[model samples]
Target chain A: MNQEIRDGLRAAVPVIISAAPFGVLFGALAVDNGLSVFEAVTMSATVFAGASQMVGIELFGQSIAPWLIVFSVFAVNFRHVLYSAAIGRRMVSFTPLQKGLSFFLLTDPQFAIAEARYEAGHRLTFRWYATSGLALYVFWIAETWLGALFGRLLPDSHALGLDFLLTIYFLGLVMSFRKRALWLPVVLASSVASIIAFNVVGSPWHVSLGALAGILVAAAAPLEGVREDEANEGRADA
Target chain B: MSDGTTLLVILGAALATFATRAGGHLVLSRFRSIHPRVEAGLNAVPAAVLTTIVAPAAFNGGVAELGALAVAALASLRFGMTTLFAAGAVTLIGLRALGL
Candidate 1:
């Protein structure tokens, strides 16, 4: 096995664990919403975005217009726009085809882990990205199939703490980035803003709104890194 | 909805979702040089976006959820990723079992 592939698998374990329940839940709900097991599995394999897929099924259950459901799913996943833009900066070595394939698997955790690796000064190679992404993709689809087939037999999710695992997982990811510049203020701003948005605006919207608030804070803060680089350049020129 | 319609809708969403995923990079790449402020903002992306997912859950949670997160945060300071995750999951399940 390639070293980066091994590392990618290592990075993927926590994600697979935290995401397992939701994948199963999504499949069960998709079936309950009138989707065939095939369709449920298809959606998992194709759309591949959990929150939006959930939104799609919920709307499907309501017998909403198909276009409306598609639009809603798009709206729910709009945050990926920001994620793609942010992570794209580090993909200098990726071929055009690799970039295309990479974007297809660019889920929230994938982006977070890739960006963290880059920040730690590691190269963002295609091998590692594809390895991690494919591992997640396979688990998600398999879990969806299992849930569609046997979701009802599963134990109580709430009692098992399945509902809150991602929250715990994400909090750990956020904590891992504490060494980054402006991390605390960014976390504070996004947290408070998301809480407000989650209450008032609703699901999905809160993510984008909350992230924007924090990014604006970072953009407007004193340019600690850039300023020092410029000062050093000025001294060198003199 | 018919099976055909369901498939169509799912495919439509897949396209739409892909657009958003690829759209940002396409738009950003057009710029020859990114401004420093923009770079700073991009650097904050992981923390900023991830915090939103975590915060609302923490806020809406009751005793069990809150306790788990608290345990998890503390565990993060001393443990590896898997250990902290286990600590958090154990705390959540334990607290919920205790009727918190």
Candidate 2:
């Protein structure tokens, strides 16, 4: 394998390792929320968005409207639209089949790594991207199954603080971007908006509104010339 | 909901979510020459949206606990602790010990 591919896979392994426990926590929560083991694993396999799956399971437990549950999942995952755009540009020269396969594996961490690689003038072949995706895919399925089976043996996750994993994941992402001061206000504003929306509107809608508000605010804010230059360089690589 | 019905619904929702993600790529692939500005904006969207979702949950779980977590987050950042799990673990343990 070329050095670029080797480096990409190496960079991705640590991320996949970190993601394993989060997957297990999701599996435990899925069953605890009253999903059957089969249903839980199926969701992990097919849906693949951890936070959305958790939200869907919670809404299911509450016996919410099916359409509302679907909408909520979409809202939570709407960021994938952005992921698609970014990844799509990188794979723009690939055949439709290759593009389609890569798109299926897109997720937050994968996108972050892929975008960074592309920006650094690294060549991301289909095989490299697929390898990262496949690793994560296997880890997610296996961890979910384990969590569902062992959930009964484990203590209450919320009490044990496993519930905090999702927050930790987000904070890590934010900390990684600490050099970009613009993100600070954008994140803070979106969070405050969501909390207010939660009080006024409620569960699913709050998430959607808060996210939309954040994206709009961030997109509107002017980036420093250096940030813009970096973004342009990343874009040029695609 | 009955077991059979719930199973059907969960499966259906899972398929729908997958389609939404897959479908975006399927459709967008046909287009050529997407605007550079749009592409740049989209690149930043995932991190921004994720931050919005995570920040409130970290700080707003409960007021006192939120304060404890803030302290932990600051400490973690100050010490250049790169692992999020470490920061979160410390905050949770500290809060419990403080009787919050």
Candidate 3:
């Protein structure tokens, strides 16, 4: 294998290792939240968005409307659109099949790696993305299965506050972009909007409203300078 | 949740999640040259979206938790700790103390 492929695989291994415990946690939580083994495993296999899956289970436990649950999950994960767009723009040179396959494998960490590669002017192909994705896929399914089997046996995880893992993960992600003052306002506004929506509209709609508010506000704000700065940085790195 | 209905709901949720995850790629596949406006929108979307999601978690906590996250963010900026490590460390400490 070429060095690029080797590097891609090397990068992907850490992600897979990290995902293993997360996957197991999801699997265990799904069962604890009252999903059957098949149901939990199927959801993990088919859906593959960890946060949305957890939220869906929580909503279901609370007897929320199914359509609302679906909508909420969609809203929470809408950022994938931007990720897909970024990858799609670059994969324009590839074939339709190549593009489709790559799209299927675009998860958060994978997208992060891919973007870093792109900004570095590295030659990232569909195959590279696919390799990383396939690795994650295996770990995800395995972890879910393990969790479903062993999750019920475990003690109260809520007391352990394992649920806060997602929160911490998001905080880390947001902090990474804290270089600019503009992001601080964006974060504050969105948080306030989401909290208000959560109280007013309640469960599912709260997520949608909060996400919409954030998207609209961020888009309308002046970000031309930030964009130019990022592009310049990317060019300099190249 | 009825078992049958729950199964259906789970399936629906999974499908919905997949759709959103896949939606952007499907939309972008047809385009050759993306409009500059669309590009701008896409670039800003993550910051907006992530900010919305993270805000509740960071501040929803009590004063101590909020303080910890603030400290973590400051540490990230000043000390140059990786965002993930710093945030994780702060949350671990804060939540442990809060007994949440």
lDDT of each: 0.93, 0.67, 0.65
DockQ value of candidate 1: 0.66
lDDT of 3 by residue, A1-238 (tens): 9676676787676466545667888888888888888988888777787767888787877878778888877776766776776566667467877776666567777776675566546777766777777777777888899999997576564544454544544554556555533566666666788788767776545545665665565556654655676645544543
- On TM-score, the stronger of 1 and 2 is 1
Deviation from native of the Cα of residue A84 in model 2, angstroms? 1.9
RMSD of 1: 2.6
Per-residue CA lDDT of candidate 1, range A103-186, in tens? 999999899888877866789999999999999999999999999999788898999999999999999989999988999999
Scored by DockQ, the top model is 1
Which residue pairs overlap in candidate 2's backbone? none
Which residue pairs clash in candidate 1? none
Each candidate's root-mean-square deviation in Å? 2.6, 4.8, 5.6
Query: Which sequence of candidate numbers ranks them by DockQ, best first?
Result: 1, 3, 2
Q: State the displacement of the C-alpha of residue A162, model 2, in Å, after optimal TM-score superposition.
A: 1.5
> Interface root mean square deviation of every model, in Å?
3.2, 4.3, 5.4
Ranking by TM-score: 1, 2, 3
In candidate 3, list every pair of residues with a backbone clash: none
Tens-digit lDDT string for candidate 2 (B64-84)? 346545655675476532344
Chain B TM-score, one value per candidate, order as shown: 0.95, 0.68, 0.69
| Ranking 1 against 3 by lDDT, winner | 1
Candidate 2 is graded, for docking, as: acceptable
